[model samples]
Target: MRVVLAEDLFLLRDGLTRTLREHGYEVVASVDNGPSLLRALLEEKPDVAVVDVRLPPSYTDEGLQAALEARRRRPGLPILVLSQYVDQLYANELLAGGDGAVGYLLKDRVTNTEQFVDAVGRVAAGGTVMDPQVITKLLSRSQARGMIDSLTPRELDVLEMMAEGRSNVAIAATLHFSESAVAKHTASIFAKLRIAPSTDDNRRVLAVLAYLKR
Candidate 1:
């Protein structure tokens, strides 16, 4: 798959480019700033983009804003954003559209090449992937909102894996439950979250992000 990468750190950017290339992803463009990232996104039209939350110029949410704008211009453009720490606001904004081809991960995750590559592939295939750390923090914050408190413990477990972009079969295997049981729990999650079936949106992504809304 073709990729556009944006990271301010030269060493990390080079390392990630090498990692993705070793895993058979074509690095179409590698940039270090938000404007360059935006240009690359529009010009390269890569299959996926790996962006750092902070980029040059403002060194704030520049990379993220570029990614979001690119998605605005080219809807469903798969993007996996990396941050030094858990930034719930950035994660929420990325998922706010309820599109599935997106991910939010910590930069530290890059050391685990296997998992990082898997996340890239998943996002490229129009799946949502959240860093485990991000998921845990979001879940913790949900207690204040109580949006997910109604869910059973088991259902909450299933929901966590779902947020990590695991398939029903994968979740079932990990949880040692039948696939049918996982399906049932998934359905219940949607119901309890009040996520109505809609042809225009991805309900699974919506369900995974429901707790963040309220």
Candidate 2:
């Protein structure tokens, strides 16, 4: 897969490039700062971007913001954000649009090269891959009243897999249910979450996620 990477650290950036290359990824443009990252994104139009949450100049959320902006410029631009820290707010922001092909993983995830590579591949294939830690934070931080409070535990499980960009068959297998049963649960989830009925799993995932963000 073609990729654009943004990490300010020289060693980590170099290491990431090496790792991705070893895994058969084409690193189209690996940049070290927000501006350069954005420029490379536009110029390279890579299939996916692996960006650190913090980057040059401000040493804050430049990379995350740039990733968001990149998605805006080119809708559904696959992105996999990495960070030394877990910030629920940033995670929510990164996932706001509910566009497919996105991920939020901690830098530690890279230690398992195979898993990390799998995440990259999944996101490139229009799948969502939020870090488990991020998912826990989102669930804990967003369990407010109204819609969220209404979902059953089983519904929540299906919704979580939906957030993971799992297809109905996968979710059914995971939940030990028939695909029709999974569809019923999804319909219930849409009703409870106030998500409008839709055939598009991407939109359904986004709608469920929008509620989770609340």
Assess the local accuracy of residue 65 in candidate 2 as a C-alpha lDDT between 0 and 100. Answer: 82
lDDT of 1 at 51: 93
> Which stretches in model 2 have alpha-carbon errors above 4 Å?
9-11, 86-93, 109-111, 135-146, 175-181, 196-199
**Sliding window of 10 residues with minimal summed lDDT for model 2:** 140-149
Assess every candidate by TM-score: 0.85, 0.77
At residue 206, give the lDDT of candidate 2: 66
Judged by whole-model lDDT over C-alpha atoms, candidate 1 comes out at: 0.83
- Candidate 1 has a TM-score of 0.85
- Estimate the overall C-alpha local distance difference test score of candidate 2: 0.82
